[model samples]
Target: MKSILTILVFLVTFGSAFSQTGEDKHPLLTDRFIIGAGWYFPTRDIKVEVAGDIEGLEDIDFDETLGLSQGDNTFNFVFFWRFSKNKFWSVRGESFSVGSTRNVILDEEIEWEDITYPVGGEAEVSFGVALYRVFFGRVISSGQKHELGGGLGIHGLNVKASVEGEGFVGDTSAGFERSETEAFLPLPNIGFWYTWAPTDKWAFSANLDWFGIKIDNISGGLWNVSPGVTYQIIRNLGVNLNYEFMNFNADIDGTDFRGSFDLTFSGPSIRVMGNF
Candidate 1:
């Protein structure tokens, strides 16, 4: 009976030592799902060209013509899932929406969709963008401190634009022209991700991804880089501080409306995640 009690004490002490040292489980290694919510600040330039009987009215610059400016600060959401036990594969998705509207007096005559507005007229221009992305990636190399990978993804884009006019000089009543375009593009990308462990309590990470393609009436490219740090407060809970820079350019042509746009968004965000 004395020998049995001694063995039980030894086993309990070993288990307690292992738990305190975290020898069997690392917080990041065991993480399977992460949901992120944050804010985005975007600066943009937009131009649209239309074709019809209207001459000299085909090209419109939202900034110079109507004083449209960059998008306002907004909230964004992201989700990630890791599917490999060895941390070799994963999938991620993100979605964001941005829009802006401006009202100004026209500096020149404008015609759209068979309607003409003379100079000294007032017009309202509104533009919006909704973006979605899904990607599958593999970790080519990984260690306790670093990871590198590459993959393919599809970016879905939806654009909505409209111009409404009032104070027309002549018989053309107050009118509006609106168009919406959507496209889903597949792109192959390469990326490198790195992690640094300053201590068992904190980890710093960064990543960069880029891709470009042109086919048919669609042509565009995308690139993003982000750096972040995570602080583990306990075994399964943590907080993240991240800075992201993103840029995308696309040209689209269709039967309804044809235009080109370039947008840049850069901002810092904070999120909380749990490892399960």
Candidate 2:
């Protein structure tokens, strides 16, 4: 039969040139970069209450006390840039840094004071930054490989408050003064994630994050909630554990002076990750 029809047309032209050279040497979509390192703990408490008419005293009472604690440990850095690699969907750009320590305590008592005006305590150093970030994802399953995500960002803040006592009336040993505040804001974020890939190079991840900042032209506000975990140790390296809750508020007016402040922070964090 004519040599079996020329051996079935040379086996269908060598199987279509080996499936088009394995789809041009394997390509679907790719672009990613990430780098990270972390640890930041911040704690602050402040209270200020002033009741009207200071220069013209009718019923005047003023009270203030502030304490800031930053667990003596700080360092955090992050950078990420990724665009489109549909595990479901993806987009990213991020930058981060945080450091802490600010403590202040002051007390003043008056009614023509038998004598009580002490401002003998001080410490300062606090910082925050988030340039830009926008990310998203979703892939419920890749046969037991899961994923989910959400995002938003933009933030900047700086703080410094220092006051030392025994110098309100006369001269003494511990007398020093400092007060500083710088803020720029527009931050919003949301997150939910779960990932696992127990084989093909190993992976594990978890996340929950909520973030906020409102400056309303200096009627300040900041909020945060965080939970995190990650481990890869290869294929790009990874390690993380984070827990955080933070809130800060402020209102101020100068020239004739006016003030209001509040702060709260909680912690536990450790991180190191890289993917490219």
lDDT of each: 0.68, 0.44
Model number with the top lDDT: 1
On the 0 to 100 scale, the lDDT of residue 241 in model 1 is: 80
| Regions more than 4 Å wrong, model 1 | 1-26, 47-65, 68-71, 107-119, 166-190
* Predicted model with the maximum TM-score: 1
Instruction: Estimate, for each residue in 18-58, the C-alpha lDDT of model 1 and write its tens digit.
Output: 33343433455446786767676666566655444555556
Per-candidate TM-scores read 0.74, 0.28
Error of 2 at 101 (Å): 18
Predicted candidate 2 versus true structure: per-residue lDDT over 185-233, tens digit per residue: 3345555555544433334455454554444434555565655555555
TM-score of 1: 0.74
Clashes of each: 0, 2
What C-alpha lDDT does candidate 2 achieve relative to the native structure? 0.44
Deviation in Å, model 2, residue 52 alpha carbon: 4.4
